[model samples]
Target: MNRTVVRTEDLWKVYPQEPKPVEAVRGVSLEIQAGEFVAMAGPSGSGKTTVLNLLGGLTRPTRGRIWIGEDEITALSDRELARLRLESIGFVFQAFNLLPVLTALENAEFTLLLRGVPAEERHRRVRELFALIGLDGLEDRKPGKLSGGQQQRVAVARAVIGEPALVLADEPTANLDTATGAALLEVMERLNHENGVTFLFSTHDPRVMERAHRLIHLVDGSVESDVAQGVRGGVGHDR
Candidate 1:
């Protein structure tokens, strides 16, 4: 049986604006099972990013509850939440977010270093992942030296090196060209298939929605529709 990796109930995130409060996410609720490749799609300002932030504990909801596995993250203390995020949640942003000063290898293994994993082990894991994702020879390059696709691939390596239970990616492929984006998606799909790493993405790209096994559409801060479909080539069929 597939385990429920994420669950939200009556989720709401309201920003206090001058004229009135803006509801970024209102009464949004959903469940994502482990190992599922899911995408949340909507127009700009449709609250997809807000929902991902709430699920990742980057922001507290104005109302409602969120759970990662059995723990209710909304109830966790700030410090506790930080720890949980570090250990169980991975994030990829539209901006590659790679530190310009660090080499690709250093950037990829930074999370492991934070968790105090020994140097040798961190290198071992990152090198293996880099090879798997077609990043073998670019390890010594910094973000400035790599192409957009390479930088994004390094960012992906960083996100998954620790093998987090869930990865929340917001517009991960927005900055890449069509071919580059497709390649990145393939890398993510491989991770989801081989390592059981669950991915929840907030994307506006149709290509992304097409690759996802489950797609949730949001509008005006609410879930307009949620559907399950087969991925291209049946790579992520329901299991």
Candidate 2:
């Protein structure tokens, strides 16, 4: 079976600052299981994004270990880590980083194309995702032609099109209005339940945290609290 869980042990990350060393992530450890919809919740500068970066293989931790299933990722080479990201992990960014020149379908199919998925198979998969993401007829529309919500949904399609073991999304709804962000969150939750994909997202939005099955709060570079299902206020801002 593919590794569907992620684990971290005594993780730490520090950046070189001009004045003094700035610690980004402190002694934080946790496990996220398959199909879990988790939110890394906190205010700004709480290290949520830093932790997401470490987990997504976009950056390495300065100390400790990270495991995605059976593989320990902290020791991997840059090339190897890049390969791991392409193979096992998917990422959604706040800015909806779609290629401006590409159509929506093209953007969603980009990763599969890089991994050498055949054209017919890739199109079929992307078409299905487009339908699921409520972008069926807009498949050929460019990012600039779409609204913020639509663009973000396209980004979501791109992230999960290849069916990665883990999907890391950072501030996915930050650019959308309240109704649009809630709608996007619903789409993600539906995907999590239907596709059995594990999703870990960093957000300051209480609406995002409220929909999460689990919440991990970060403060001062450390995990301030880890709350499981049904604990809404454990790590969220007030409405």
Candidate 3:
């Protein structure tokens, strides 16, 4: 059986506003098994990004709990949460957040450097990953020198280099053209299939929804439907 890498129990997040409080997530309970390619889809303000932020330890929930591989993130101290995020979770954002000053290789290996990995080992791993992802000859280029698609690939390389248990991507393809987005999705799919890297994305793109093994739809801060897709031979079921 596959291990459960993420679990949430009645998760809620409310933002205080002048007129009234806004509920971003309500009573959301779900479990994501290891190596599943899942996507959360919804219209604007459906709490997709909020849930990812809550799961990634980027924000504290207004109420309820979240667990990543048996560790209750809701109860952890800020320091402990930071440590847990560093060791277990990776995040890919829409903006392709690479340091402008660093070379592609340097940006991709930043996480390893933070963990005190030796220079030689870091270079070896990044080089191998670059070659696998069609980034072999661009290691010395800076982010400014790369195209939008190339920058996003470098972002993905950075996220997966440390071999984190889960990667949460928030509209990673939002900034790319259709062709670029499709190529990026293919790269992620290959990683998930070949390396068993679990990916969870919150996106509005139909292309992303179509390719996901499982799709979870949200409306008005609640889960409306969760179904497995047929594209990857996934069994259909409600969560």
1 or 3, which is superior by TM-score? 3
Compared with the true structure, all predictions reach lDDT values of: 0.91, 0.87, 0.92
Task: For candidate 2, report its TM-score.
Answer: 0.93
- For candidate 1, the TM-score is 0.95
Task: Write candidate 1's Cα lDDT for 1-239 as tens digits.
Answer: 77888989999999999899999999987888888899989999999999989999999999999999889999999999988988999989899999999999999999899999999999999999999999998889989999999999999999999989899999999999999999999999999989889999999899999888888889999988888876422123221
Residue-level lDDT tens digits of model 2 in 1-239: 32447999999999999999999999998878777889988889989999999998788899989998777999889988888888888999999999999999999998899899998999999888888878899988999999999999999998999898899999999989999999999999889988987899999899888889888888988988887765321233222
Clash totals, every prediction: 0, 0, 0
Can you write out model 3's per-residue Cα lDDT over 1-239, one digit (the tens) per residue? 67888999999999999799999999898888888899999999999999999999999999889999989999999999988888899889999999999999999999999889999999999999999888999999999999999999999999899999999999999999999999999999999999889999999999999999999998988988889884442344664
Q: Arrange candidates by TM-score, descending.
A: 3, 1, 2
Model 1 residue 238 CA deviation in Å? 17
User: Which TM-score value belongs to model 3?
Assistant: 0.96
